[model samples]
Target: MSISRLSSALVASLLLFGAACGDDTVGTSPNNMTTPPGVDVPIPMGSKLQHTGQCAGQVNCQVDVTFNSSAPLQVRVIDGNGAPVVGAAVRYELSVGLAVGTSLNAASAQTNSDGVAQVEIRAGQATGAAEVIVSLPGDTSVAPIKFVAGVQPKDSASYSVTFEHAGTASLRDIKVFLYKAEDSCDAIREDIARERDDDASTNPVLTAEYTANGVASVDGTLPLVVFPGLSNGQSFNVAAQAMSRDDGEVELAFGCTDSNPPIENGNSVNVIVRLEDHLPRLKGSFDVTHTFSITDAICDPQPNGGYAGVLPSGVCLAIDLIGRLATDPASFILGEGSGDTGIIGLIVDFLPDDGILGTLKGAIESFLGNSLIQNLGRDALNEFFATWIENNAPDWVKGGIDITADIYESLQEFRVNGIIRIEREPDPTLDTETNTVVGLLNADQDGNRPGKQVWEDIIVYWTGDCASSAPAACRERTFSATDLGATSSVVEGSFTGTVVPLTGEGETGFGLIINEHTLALNYGVLILGIIEQVVLPSIFGPTVTSLEAALNELLLLVLPGGTTGCQGFADFMVDNIGSSVETIARNLCESLLESASDGIREFLTENLTISGEDNFLLATPTGTPCKLVEPEAYTGAWIGKPLPYIDGLGTDSMLCEWDVKIRISQDTIIETDGTFSGNRTGF
Candidate 1:
C-alpha cells in the first residue's frame, strides 16, 4: 500500500485502542471509569486542559493541511499540581466557514492513562483557516485549549499578462517570462529559453501574437505556476520580448512590468508590461593604436666608486601597440610593432647564491682565449701589463680583488602583440522615474552587480627586433611571430559602467561609458626572454669586445723588458674583469628581474587601461532612429572621445580622439561560434 494509506490505517488503529480503554467519567480514575446515564458530575476543581503531541504548547499549536488531507488534534488533562488526571471526559469543537465540511473522528473523548486525548480532523474542499477548541465537560470556569489549521489549495496560482508596445514595427509574436523579483532580466531570458529547449513541458508562462502595425496591445492568460519556495502574498517579476520580421530579417523589442505583483491563491493577477524599441546589439571589429614612452634610471650610484662608475647614465624605452577589438563573443587582437629609438635599461645585481661570479669568469676567459700569452708578442704583453697597472693597481694592490660592476643597457624600443577573447552581456533594467531603460555591460552575463571576466585565447608576441650593430647572438635571439604559446595570466576585470541612449547635436544613437579599469599582464616569461636573449647579447657583446681591443692596443705600447711582472699584472686584470661580468649577470638574473617586472606592471596599471569618462558613441544622422535593417546589418562611424582624465596617453591630443568605420550585424551568435568574417581596415 501507499505510505499515506498505511499512515491512515495506523492512526485509525491507535484511535480505536485509545477509545476502548478511555474513561467517560468527569475526573479521577487511574485508567478507566464509567458514569451513570444522565449523571451531572462536575470536573475536579483546578483541573485544566493542555495541548500536547503534534499540538504541543504554543509553538506547535498551528499547522497547514491540504484539501482532503487530515491532521491530528491532541490535548492533555492536568490538575493544578501539574500531574496527569486520567479518566476525564473531553469535548472538541472545530470552527466553521472554510472549515464547514471538516469533520472530527470523535466529538467527545476521555483521557487515557497518560491523561492524553486525541482526535483526527479531516479537511473538506475549501481553502482557509480552521480552529479546534478542546475543553473539559461541565468545566465552565477553566479555559479551553485552541489549535489552528490552515487549509492549502490543491491547484497552482494563475496569472495574466498584457503586453503593450509603442514601436512602429509589426510584431509577429511576443514571449513573456515570469521570474522572481531578485532575478536579472538577462539571466531570466536565457535560463527560461534553455529550460524550454531542454524539456518541451518547460515552455514560457505566456505568449501572444499580433499582426497589426504601430502601437498595439495584446493580452494572454499565463499558464504559470507560482515559482517554487514562494508562498501566498509573495511578489514576482514579468518580462517580455516582442519579435518583428521584415522580409527575411528579424528585429526584437523588449519590455517589463514596472512593479512586481503579489501571488494570490485561487485567483489570476493581471500585469501590464510596457514595451520599447531598444538599440539592437551590435557586433563588429575595431582597431586601436596606443603609443607611450618611459624614461627612468635603473640603478643608483654606489659608494667606493664601485660598479656604478661603469654603468650607463639612464634609459629611455618607447612602446607602440595596435589592438583590435571585436564583439559577438568578444575578443581583442593586439599587434606589436617597432617604436622610436631610445635607450632601454638593462640593470643587473649579484645574487647571494648560485656562484654567478664563477660562471661569468669562465665565459669571459673562454671569450678572451685561455692561452693569452702564447697568442700575443712580447712587446704587446709588456704594454698590456703597463695599462693594467695604471688602471687597476690602486684597488688590487690594497688587498684581494673584491669588484662589483653596476651596469645598465639602453633599449631603443619595446612592443607587444596579442589576442584575447572575452565575454560581455547587457544587463538592462527599467528606470521608473525617467521611463527609460538603461543597461550595464556585465562581464560574466550575471546580475546587475559587477562580475569577473576571464579573458580567453590570449596569445602575446614580443615583436621588437635587435639593432643592426648587434652581434649574431642578439640577432639570432629575436622573437618569432608564429609561435603562439599559451600563458597562465588571467586578467581579473569588470565592466560596471552604463550604456545609455544618446541624442543631440545632429546625432541620435547609443554610447557606452568606460570609466576606470585595470588590466594585469604576467611578464615573467616575456621579461626573462627579453633580458636573456636580446638585452644581454646586444649590449655586452659589443662593449666587452671594444674594451678588450683597447686594452690590447695599450699593452703594445709597454716595454718588453719586465716580462714576468707584465704576466702577473695580465692575470690579475683578467680575473677581476671576469668577476665584474659575473657579478653584473648574476644581479640581473636575480634582484633586477623582480624590480623590472614590478616596474612594467606598474606602468601598465597606471597608463595602459582607460580611466574617467571614455565615451564610445555609435551615432546615426539626426531624425533617423537607430534600427536594424535588411541583412540585419548596420554601417556607421564610431567615435571615441576621452574627457577630463587624459593621463593614459600623456598630453598627446592626437591620442584623445578616434573615428573609425564600423560595420556590424545582428546575425552573430555569441553563445556558440566566436568567429567573424569581414574586411579589416584602418589599422
Candidate 2:
C-alpha cells in the first residue's frame, strides 16, 4: 500500500465513526442542543433585559419595564435549535412612557455560561412595557419579549337602590332603573352593551307589585362599570318612572339611589316622575262682590203692598242660572271623571260611590216678603248665594249675567225638563284626618268651570192671557224660560203696580216681579251625619269587627302600630255605628290580609347563590411568579391556582338551595322575579 493513500483513508474513517457515535443530528430538532433545521438564531439590538408577570386568571398582562437603556438597544440569549442559547444578546431602548429607570443609559449584565441573565431594576422606576429585540449571528434562539414592570391590584365598587313610594302612596305606579357607567378601557369595552341589557332586558331589575294594601317594593345591588380606554373621571345616571292603571294621585323625587330614593348613592343619581295628578278641583278668579238677584212672585206692585230697601226677614232663593259650558274637556267633564251627582236636569250617568244633590222645597216662603215663612233666614239665604258665587264661581262668570229684583218668577222649569247636568268632581285630596271630601271639594274646579253663569235668574213666569182680569195672581208666575227678553211680546204675567229703579246696579231694577232659578246642593252628606248622630245601632247592625278595618287604616296615618293610637282607633271603630264606615272597614280588612301574605313571602326568599365562569390567560416573555414559565423560550405555561368551585361538586354543577315558599295561592307561578299567586282571577 502507498503511504499517502493509507493516511487519508484512516482520517476519513475516524471522522465518520465519531459523527455516528454522538447521536447529535446536524439539523435542528426539538431537543437538539445546536441550531434546529429550520429555526434561525435571533440578533440583539441592546444590552438591557426587561419583563412583566401574568397568570391564567388575567384578562390583561402588565407591561412593566424593569431595566432600561438610553440609546437604541436590544436583549438576547444564546440557544440551540430547540432551547434558549446560553450566550445570546437581548437589549432595548427606553422612552418616557416605557422608562423603568431614571436614566435610559442603564444596562443589564451579560448572561452566565448557561445563557441565563437578569437586569437590576432601579427604585421608584415608572411602570410600563418596552419592546425588546433578540440579536444573533444567523442563530434565532430567543423570541422578542413583551417586557413590562410594576404590577398592582385594583379595587372595585358596588351600588344599590330602592323606592320611597313602594308602600303607602296614593299613586303607586313608579319604576326605577340603574346603569353602570361606560368607560374607555379595552378590557371592559363590551360591558357597555352588557350593562344596557342588564338594566333593561334580562335584568336583575328590581320591581314593585300591587297588593290589596299596595306594600311591595324594589331594591338590590348594582354591578360595577368600567370605561374603554378611560383613565379617570367616571360617573353614572339613574332614571325613575311613575305608572298607573286609573288616574290616581302620585308624587316623585330625584336624588340618589337609596332606601329613601330621596338620598343619593355614591355613583347613582335619581330622576322622579309623576304618573297621576289630582289637585285644584275648584277654581274662582273673579270678584264676587255683586249682590245676586232675589226672585219672588209676591214682590209684584199689585194689591199686596210691601216696603222697599229691606228684604223680608224670610228665607229666600237667590235667582241665579247657568248652562253646561264646555270650553276645555280636560278640566271639565260633567258626568265623566266625576262622582255621582243628584239630578241636574240632564241625562247624566252616576258613578257608584258619588253622593246625591240637595232637595228642592218651598220657594214661596223664601220670597214671600215675610221672614216667618222661610225655614232659613232671608239674610242667611242671601249670604249663602253670594258666598257660593264668591267661592265656587270662576273669575270670568261674575260679570256675565244682567238682572233686577222686579222680576216675579218660579225656578222650576230646569228641573222639570233636564237642561242642566251636575256631576261631582273626583276627590283625590283625601283627608288623612276626616277621610272626607270637605277639604278636597274646595280644590275641585272640574265640576263647574269658568263662564258658566249666563243669566241672573231663570224665571218661568206665568204664560197666561195678558188681557185677563181674573183674581188668580198666586198662580201667575209660570212660563217657559225662553220667552224672556222678547221685545213688545205679551208679558207672561202683568206687573200691576208702579215701576221703580233700583240703585247701585247689581241685578236691581223694578219692571215686573218674575222668574227665578233654583239648584240642588249635596244635602245627602248632611243627612248621613244626622242619621249617624240619631239612630246608630240600626245602621251598623254588624259588630264593630265589621268596621274595625276602616278605622284601623285611618289610625295608621294618625296613630302608630301597636301603640295607644292603634288601640284608640280600634275602640273608635267599635263605638261607631254607620253602614258607610262599616263598608270602609271591610275594604281595609282585605288590604291587611294582603300585607300579611307579602311579609311571609319576603321572609322565605332571603338569600341566594349564583354561578359564573372566569377564564383567561396571558402571553409574553414567560416570567411568572406562579412558576408556570418554562426554562426554554417560545412557549406557554400555567402559574395560577385552580378555578374556584363548589366543594364536592363537578365542573357542570349548580347550587341546590332549600327554602319554604310562603304562597298567597294554593300553588304559585314561578317566574324570574319570583313566585306569584297562580289564581290571578281571585286576586
TM per candidate: 0.29, 0.18
User: Highest lDDT: which candidate?
Assistant: 1
Residue 347 lDDT, candidate 1, scale 0-100: 18
Could you list the CA RMSD of all candidates, in the order they appear?
24.4, 35.3
Q: How many clashes in each candidate?
A: 12, 87
Candidate 1 per-residue lDDT, tens place, 512-570, comes to 44434433332222332344343333323333222122222222233335433234334
After TM-score superposition, what is the CA distance of residue 392 in candidate 2 from its true location, in Å? 46
lDDT of residue 324 for candidate 2: 17
Q: Where in model 2 is the C-alpha error above 4 Å?
A: 1-169, 178-234, 245-304, 307-483, 486-683
- Model 2 worst lDDT window (10 residues): 674-683
